[model samples]
Target: MMETSKGNTSPLKVQLVYTTNIQDPNVYSEVQEQRESPAPPKTSAAAQLDELMAHLSEMQATVAVKADISKRHLPDKQDHEASLDSMLGGLEQELQDLGIATVPKGHCASCRKPIAGKMIHALGQSWHPEHFVCTHCKEEIGPSPFFERSGLAYCPKDYHQLFSPRCAYCAAPILDKVLTAMNQTWHPEHFFCSHCGEVFGEEGFHEKDKKPYCRKDFLAMFSPKCGGCNLPVLENYLSAMDNVWHPECFVCGDCFSSFSTGSFFELDGRPFCELHYHHRRGTLCYGCGQPITGRCISAMGHRFHPEHFVCAFCLTQLSKGIFREQNDKTYCQSCFNKLFSL
Candidate 1:
């Protein structure tokens, strides 16, 4: 067919536009015509509008598909991010909780320190961290709460104890226990063991075996011991003064400072030996500067030592050394020589 382009000497022809491959002879010929054609008629406004509408419709379909894809992917992405955030938040909270303190202050008795687990003391009583205790006997009085409520820290049973008292020794305030202890009270460890004839670390008051044994009794390997007197202890029954004593006993009355080698001297209604003993006296001697070992040396008249007279010329000591009395005034040798020369 002859194609016609604009008034530019082109054959007038209708070349069909195509997308798929043209296999038919007619379709191939149409492509060849389109190739030869130099120009085509200017599309009318209606025709242009129709073409623009077709493109707009295709674009709209493509935009709808993209929006659907975005909608499907956006929700999933947001949910995943939120789940991760929640897990991170939980882990952070777990870490913070793990660091919480297990013990609180004012829970420990002696040291007033924090206590995490259970701790039971010797007295068989439950106690808090800050509580009164006896330093001498290691007796725990009570929790700080009772003291906080009332001014006292111990019960009256603790006052008159003859031996070790922990709370009193530590100087903590006595509840009623210290007062009672001062009267007739004794700790559980105060009873004397009849076997060893020695006071045990603890006591059993009502225990009237009359033959009481202490921890030492259980620890003793062999040999039965006396329940009344210790080995070498003498027994006496003089009215209310029935007390047993050892022949070689040298224990101190003041600080338990024992005397050794075994000796005795009568002093203040008690036997005291020279060893493990000391005496106090006032007067001092000018010669030795110590309390006289009980006597003094003196210079009298012409029988005086040289130390008792000064040299006639030098006016110094006459030099018979110390503890001496010569003719008159005590004088050193140098002074005596000067006096003799004069």
Candidate 2:
């Protein structure tokens, strides 16, 4: 008879019975055996390497599948972020168009108060519509034309009064038309000669000391007059003896010769060249009877050359000291005493 038993710890169990024919048939021997299943043959290193390679190939395929999935979805993620940014930008623009953007609150430049509701932007500042007014007149000005000067706003009337060109003569503002002369502005009707107080025509005029004058008035009032011709010296005049004269008129009073470029002398407000002056006014020497053109000595209404005036008897030059006169002749005091004294 044979029997088998199996359990969790033991893999296989077998019981065997054997009968001896020579002995007692009835007597039987029992044998029991337990055996575990044998393990398979040890594998080679090459086989182990091949198995590792197969596992690695499977892992690589799985990683490649994950990468492909990520690559396909990356564009969608970026597009979603970009769309969110664009939507935010559109919302901002819409807010601005509706005047609800997060703009900083401004203050009125004129009143220095917080500006609310409607505002006027000008002169690099913000102001309430009603607060922006003309600085000069202190009147509200907006939507209408205005002017600015020195960082202050003004209306047209006040602007013109404060800044417009003025007449040089009257010192009044010239609004409509202006005439510029002598580096100054004037009203057309006010542009006139300062001397005659007459308005200048299209003809030429002159300026002196920043005052305008007509040609005729300028010549008569300011031009130098020739002493000889008694006419206004237009040009090419000579100045002598504190008087001005035309070149042709400046001649010798005696010879009437032009002293255009020569030395002259003035006698009784008349010009005389050197030759004529000397010849006409030269005194005759009493001793030599010749014209005393050089240094001379005069005594008793008579002129004598310095070298010729000598003592009558001694014949010495009478250079200094008092001399005596007799019969229209001069003698030294010593000679006179020697000749007359007893």
Candidate 3:
């Protein structure tokens, strides 16, 4: 019997204890006494304690789960923070290159636009923080607050012109050149022929010899391509207003002789007509690299290949001797002293 708080029962009652028969009179009497005392019985103590322990375990488990969730989310937060730092570092370098004396506070100087948080360039030299000016321009310098983004300081004027000296390449007294940035300069006449080092004044295409270089050179000298013609001359290419010659094409522009038919050579950066350039290896005296083939000297005398050495004093044929090894300048002992005296 439990008491009802609905104004319908007494405060003291025996809950879960009923009077069956008059079997256990002593037990019945004890229940009645406990109802009078209005307290729980001794047998119910362990049950109440067990219920409390169950509630405590549930609370502990809930807290442990919450802690685990926080631990899992921490690394994601750290990664986001790292990405922000990297972005900021890159912007700082750009600001330095612009030669900005100070960091802009709000609006852009050149475009006169509001700078958003994401698009705000740290490189600008003019900006406004307190006022919403549609344009950023230099006014009277007021005693206002300033800040340095990288090494640059800013107040309110355009400081892009305060950077460095002009570029040496295209900064000319003439008006044809254009300066893209304060540093990058270029001339308007840069697209002419790269071979003759000639500034092509007209718009006509030109070619010479069999190695077509230019029309001017072909008529002046005998025209014909090199022994190794049109082969994307990697070492050099054709050049010449006097005649057609590969940049690497060492055919004589005067004699129509091939000089470097299958070898390497620097483009002479000059006008080489077809008949003048000569490239002859077998006929050339290997000693001084002069022609001696059909004229007389055998290829195997105290024969010095172009790559061999000869003594200046006695004309002694010297192999790769100790003294000849350096630049292969083979000098007899006497010639060495005579040359070194100077």
Worst 10 residues of 3 by lDDT: 22-31
Query: Taking the tens digit of each residue's C-alpha lDDT, what string does model 3 give over 97-153?
Result: 432122323455545644332221223233333331212244422223232334444
- List clashing residue pairs in candidate 2: none
- Tell me the TM-score of each prediction against the true structure: 0.16, 0.41, 0.15
Candidate 1, position 61, lDDT? 69
Please give the clash total of every predicted structure, in order: 60, 0, 40
> Candidates sorted by lDDT, descending order?
2, 3, 1
Give the least accurate 10-residue stretch of model 2, judged by summed lDDT: 19-28
Alpha-carbon lDDT, every model = 0.38, 0.68, 0.39
The true-versus-predicted C-alpha distance at residue 312 of model 3, in Å, is 49
Better of 2 and 3 by lDDT: 2
TM-score of 3: 0.15
**lDDT for 318 (candidate 3):** 52
Comparison by lDDT, 1 against 2, better one? 2
